[model samples]
Target: MPAERQTETIDGHEVSLSKPDKVMYPDAGYTKADVVGYYRRIAPIILPHLRDRPVTRIRYPNGTGTRPFYEKNAPAGTPDWVRLATLSTPGSSKGRDTADFPVVEDTATLVWLANLAALELHTTQWMIGDDGETRRPDRLVADLDPGEHTGIEDCVEVALLLRERLASDGLTAYAKSSGKKGLHICCPISGEQSDGDVSAYAKALAKELEVERPELVTANMLKKERDGKIFIDWSQNNAAKTTVAPYSLRGLGVPTVSAPMTWDEVEAVRELRFTPDEVFERVDEGGDLWEPMLERGPKVPEVEAPKRRKRAARPRS
Candidate 1:
């Protein structure tokens, strides 16, 4: 028989946790409660990134050994206190309507999602306003994907080069591992640039990187064209797109975390791939290294601003 369910009060809100004893990570024997505990510990740094953003959770009911499915809309039994954002995007593959995705603004909501075995917390780059309208991205991500037989080491070197290149161009870029094979170098896109503008700019930047290091980097998304090179994927900047949230636990062996890191840490691959325990301890020591990504409005150099509307509409709040 399954373990008994329990109700816990978090942030003055009641959240019912079911089957807390179910092992979500078999290798490490980490139960559903362990996942909740991890999220609770990392909520401070993670929740800020998720505030007002619609989340698409990757659920693994039978642990990492089994197949996982993407869930966009919050389940019907979501707590009344947990907020929801009705977005107009491509719904899930299962044909479920995701016009409403659960928003993780507080610890209670974060822990609630974790208990559902939502191992990968993928969130949109944009933020929602009071009227629930999602806007442009605050930062642009260059997902450095390495091709065939290559590893994180290649991505690390490319990330360092990209960092310097962006700095010389007058933009600040931050690096973090994808908790898998690649490194994601995020550049802060400030001012008021539309999603299309940011996406085009990122594509241009990727093309320039490809031009500079044809032997080591390729902007081609095709697998056939990219062999032993890092491809800078610029598509993650789309308004309808989402990427794995930093500090969220990935559904990998032993629960690897999509933790944030500095440029120096990127130089060291071992430090980049942080496990659950290491991530918790790292937070206990260094605080949140990626907090700069959330505190927007730093005037990114040469940002492409959208044109003034012809309709004389109200300005962005």
Candidate 2:
């Protein structure tokens, strides 16, 4: 018989977990308790990245293979210790009804979310600031998505190109496999820019890359035009937009993680992937290589936008 609930001590905080023995990864036979435990083990390192960021919980109540839905506003009956951030639309605090979002403060709250089957943690690049109402983004993400016929290798190629381009602009970025079929390259900033500004900047950079390497990259988001190229998804840097947090487990059949990687590791991804236990090991040995993501802001100098090029007219059939 399966257990109905569990009460575990995590970081000295007692977390009440329901459906502890419920199968959350059906094929792997891993239970909800197992995922909670994983989060508990990784809480120390992963917690910092999640600190202050409003999280969007992607829950799979039954199992990873079953139905899942996104929950941005934390559900009812949330504990007091688990902090919540409220932000109104257009990034204001005074003009409208506010929505309360959960902020992960410690391992106990993390365990609670995990127990709720919040397997994928999606957070904004920005945090609500100390003054209590600022939505300025501190990170920029360039999501390299491959087309139907393309693969991770293509994304890797484009990512390397982007890495070089960002370097020339005096900023450094960290790369991580999306734990599925994509790659997310991120740059930590000084938290001084609006979400709109960062979004526009990402779009401009993607457009610049598209113009330079038309055959390999495309800013066009439509599926038909991206059959064999990499699509630079820049829309994720917006105020309400959220990307998967590093160390979050993806519901991709196996317990795959959105693990961080070095440039060389990305180049040789075909050789191996960081598995669930493997990621824990990586943290145990190297600490968070992604720590640099919170280190400094971009040193980008202002540059004039590139002029649009006129494409040659197509001949009539």
Candidate 3:
């Protein structure tokens, strides 16, 4: 009988699931069953997008005692439609099993996951910014957390301004909420660029933005320094830094907040109207608005630096 599984009640629904050997789901309210059911309901929709893509699975606890998280491929005998992965925090921490979903590499897989999350959880929120033109297949995303405020409108403004500056250089960008107190701005780059190159580009962009709008944007990583401002976190582009996978569930115990949005809507929002409780409802009603953007070309510009004007020698003083 389906391996005599465990079950739990979430939002008053009985969800069936199998527990990880040593891991635990982050949210106290969600049972192992709920987690498994979540995967099952969305698996079919996600598989076609992930077929034949090279993937890297991030294990929860990622070491001895932690369960193996599979990515890129489903576990042996599992259906091809099931794109499951395991993830663990470093050193095999027990409590960290909270964030152990396998991350699929294909963009289509991610989009499907996003759609499912939006449909089931009711947390579809969109943020469009000025860098709409810079969208590309190869992307570098940095999650800029604005602690305490978590205001979607404020975050969108930051994203738009960043887009404007990047657009001048012919780069395209997009932004979304973290489903928490910050935003994620993804820049399109030539996939040809390495992590280092992406980091360089992001750092330069953040630095330039900080220079132009010091009051609003800071590239600093220190929380104390970033008080009341958005930090342009370039570190996320580093191979070691992990930004939220597009559709992956967060550790918040509730459905995550990030949602794909159209540039026009991003510019139109007075504030974030969506919430986690409403994510699934919104998806059921309608899904992502930024899907078209996924297929668009890189929009970065090619411009040469201006020559410095040599000053004529004044009278020898």
lDDT of each: 0.82, 0.84, 0.48
Give lDDT tens digits, candidate 3, residues 152-248.
5666778888778777777666766555566677765654544566666677778777788787778888788776678888876654344543433
For model 2, state the Cα shift of residue 100 in Å: 1.0
- The true-versus-predicted C-alpha distance at residue 113 of model 2, in Å, is 0.3
Q: TM-scores of all models?
A: 0.90, 0.90, 0.58
Worst ten-residue run, lDDT, model 3?
Answer: 120-129
Q: Global CA lDDT of candidate 2, please?
A: 0.84
How do the residues 1-317 of candidate 2 rate in per-residue lDDT, one tens digit apiece?
A: 86687687766767788988888887788888789889989998889999898888899988888889888776888877778887664553334466788999799999999988999999888886886578888888988888878877788889999999888877788998788888999998878777777777788889999999888899888989898899999999888788999999988666788899988888877732466798998888889989998775863444455689999999999
Pairs in steric clash, model 2: none
| Candidate ranking (lDDT, best to worst) | 2, 1, 3
Which candidate order results from sorting by TM-score in descending order? 2, 1, 3
Writing each residue's lDDT as its tens digit, candidate 1 over 172-227 gives 88877788777788876673767887787778778888898888888888998778
C-alpha lDDT of residue 33 in model 3: 41
* Model 2 lDDT at residue 215: 86
